[model samples]
Target: MLKIGIIGYGTIGEDVVQAIGKDREGGIQVTSILVRDRSKYVVPSSLADLMTEQEAVFFANDFDIVVESAGHGAVKLYGEKVLAHGADLIVVSVGAFADEALQKRLMQKATERCRKIIIPSAAIGGLDRIAAGSLGPMEEVTLITRKPPKAWYGTLIEQQVSLTELTEPYCAFDGVARDSARLFPESVNVSAALSLAGIGFDRTKVKVFVDPHITSNTHEIEARGKFGQIMLQIQNTPSARNPKTGYIVAMSVMKTLRDRASHFVIGV
Candidate 1:
């Protein structure tokens, strides 16, 4: 069985573990989970014996892979240590890669240990073509994300734009992928993933909108290059616990974990 260590037992991490538990015979199990405050959460029976402090994950030899479903802070804190210790790191918080130095350090550590820092397609698609286009000449790659105004309540958008007064959709941000990912870490994981696969962060365009007309989180990706134009739109349900994260994001993590244990892989 594949032993998995998870960083942060937040909404995404808990969902990932619950999905794993549903299929106990999938050959992957959560061996250890690290959270900011363990006392606040009631972990499932499966992880009751394996829960530990965030630092403990670095020293433990029990897990083969570490899934980072934590936020950017957690990734910065434990990412390099986890990879340096010889465990493959599955990064769900791809937005954290916006820190160029941190990204380089984690890549260096993984390379040194012969481990991998895996980035999964969380809530968007067409990355295979985009990644291939990177080898050729790519002209443009734009990611436009839309969510309900309520989702922007506590974010920067709220301070700049009045979500309550807006009756229609309004574009809240327009910038490069790096800034978008850093500014909206919780909601824009797909931006970083798309940027990493298709182009560098600086070149990737990003637009974020708060829509009173829409309820679910929507992502529209447009890429034009030597590989021709590829456009993908995915309307994902908002995660019950986290409005910033779409429901499909957690499922994507589960799919990535499944692919790790499966003998026959489907997509790239």
Candidate 2:
């Protein structure tokens, strides 16, 4: 079994735990969960036995992988440590890579420790095709994301426009993927993933919009290169626990874990 530790018990973390519970034979197991404050954490009945608050608990176990579903701060705190401890790191908070220094450091740690840094397609799809096209001479790669008004709550976009009173689609941000992660960390994991896969952060273009009429989180990717032109779009229902993230995000994480132990695999 692939023993794993998960950081945080937020929406994505809870969903991932429940997913692993549902598939007991998938060859993945949750060894421990690290939370900020165990006292305040109300563990779900099913996962009560796996909760832990100490950092030492992670190092004690023979964890094959550690999943980071917490915010970027958690990634900054535990990313290198996890790699150094001999477990592959699955980073759900790809936005943390916005800090070039931190990204390089974690990558160096992974390289030195001989552990992999996995980035799942949590928010969007078509990354495999984009990464493949990147081998050729790629000219331009762009990502456009649109989400309902509620999804923009607590984000920096509120200062730009009134999300609640918006009548039409409002463009919240337009810039390179690096700035996208800085400005809207919670909302633009797709941009960060795209930038890393297709091109460097400085070269990848990103646009974010708040659409009151739309009920789902929408993402579109367009790339033109010597390999060819690729255009893809997906509409995902927002997670009920958190409007900022799509429900499929957690499912993608589960897929990544399951793929590791599956005899038959698909996709890149």
Candidate 3:
């Protein structure tokens, strides 16, 4: 069996473990979890033997891979350590890569240690074509994200405008991916992923919208380059336990792990 370690015990992490446990293929299992408060959260019976981040690093040396579903802070805290231990790390919080210095450091460590870092297509699609076009003379890339008004409640948009009073769709912010990540850290993973796949953060345009009519979070990408013009959109349901995160984000993480363990892989 392929042993896996999870960096967070939040909704995405719990969902990944549950899906793996329910899969009858019997090839992958979550061996350990790296959580800040193991006692505060009730871990599933299957993963009762959870470990702290430090302990997880010790186990990562033996595990097949480590999945980081934790927030950006956790990624910055333990990413290099996991890679230096010779374990592949799948990071769901790709938005953290907007920090150029941290991204360079992580890449350097991974390269030096001959380890791999995986980024899943979270809540967005058509990344393969985008990445391919990046090899050519790409000119522009844009990301537009739409979510329910309540989704932007605690964000800077909430402080700027009343989400409850918005009767129509309102574009809250427009800037580059680096600025977008800083402005909307919890909601800009797709943008960050696209930025990393196609162009650097400064060149990727981002627009955030709050829609009163939309029930689910929506993401759209438009790109123009020498290769051609590509447009893609995805509407994702929010996780029942965590409204800020899309349900498809968790499913994407599972797909990434499955592909890693499977001999026959589909799509890059």
Candidate 4:
């Protein structure tokens, strides 16, 4: 059985466990769940006993892989430690990689330990094509994200446009993927994924929209290269627990985990 450890027990974390039960054809087990306040949330009967230390790096040696679904802050805090324990890491908070040095350092540690730092195609798809196209010359890659106004709360978007007073869609940001990821860390993770898959952060363009006119979060990705022109668009339903992100992000992570252990794998 493939033993797994999860770093968060929030909405996405809960859904991941359900997903494992839904389909674990290849024998995947949740051995541990480390949360900030374990007392606040009740653990499922099957996984109650595996609740373990959130801070001890050596504790991760018990699991084959550690999944980080907490947030960017958790990545900065414990990511390296998890990798140092010689356990592979799955990062749901890809936005945290916007810090070039941190990403490199973590990758370096994973390499030294012979472990992998994996990032799921969270909240988007078609990254396979982009990654493949990297072997050839790529011309352009762009991501346009539209979300509800409340999702923009506390973001730098508030300084430029009034999200509350907006009646229609407002382009709150237009920049490269790096700046977009840093500026809108909560919602623009798709930008970081795009940059990582295809071109470097500076080359990938991004546009963030504060759209009160819409309920669902939408993203449009366009890429052109030797592989040919491809445009992928998806509208994601917001998570009930947090409006700042989409529920599909959690499902995407679950799918990645399943594929890791499944006999049949899809995509590149």
Best by lDDT: 2
Instruction: Candidate 2: list runs displaced more than 4 Å.
Output: 44-46
lDDT of 4 by residue, 1-268 (tens): 7888888877778888778878737578887788877678776667676665556632645878889988888899879988887789998888889999999999899989999988888888888888998889999999999999988777888889887799989988888999888887777888988899989899999998899989888899999989899999889998877777888877888777777777888875
lDDT of each: 0.86, 0.91, 0.85, 0.84
Separate clash counts for every candidate? 0, 0, 0, 0
**Candidate 4: segments with Cα more than 4 A from true spot:** 24-26, 45-48, 57-61
Q: Candidate 1 vs candidate 3: which has greater TM-score?
A: 1
Q: Write model 3 residue lDDT over 1-268, tens digit each, in one string.
A: 7888888878898888888888777688777788887776765565675556466454644777889888899789889988887788899998899899999999999999888999998888988999999999999999999999877766788887888789999988889999888788787788899999998799999999988998999988999999999988889998778777888887888888888778988988
TM-score of 3: 0.95
Query: Residues 66-92, candidate 1, lDDT per residue (tens digit)?
Result: 999888988898898888777899899
Model 2 scores a C-alpha lDDT of 0.91
The TM-scores, one per candidate, come to: 0.96, 0.97, 0.95, 0.92
Model 3: lDDT of residue 178: 91
Q: Model 1 off-target regions past 4 Å?
A: none
Answer with 2 or 3, whichever has the higher TM-score.
2
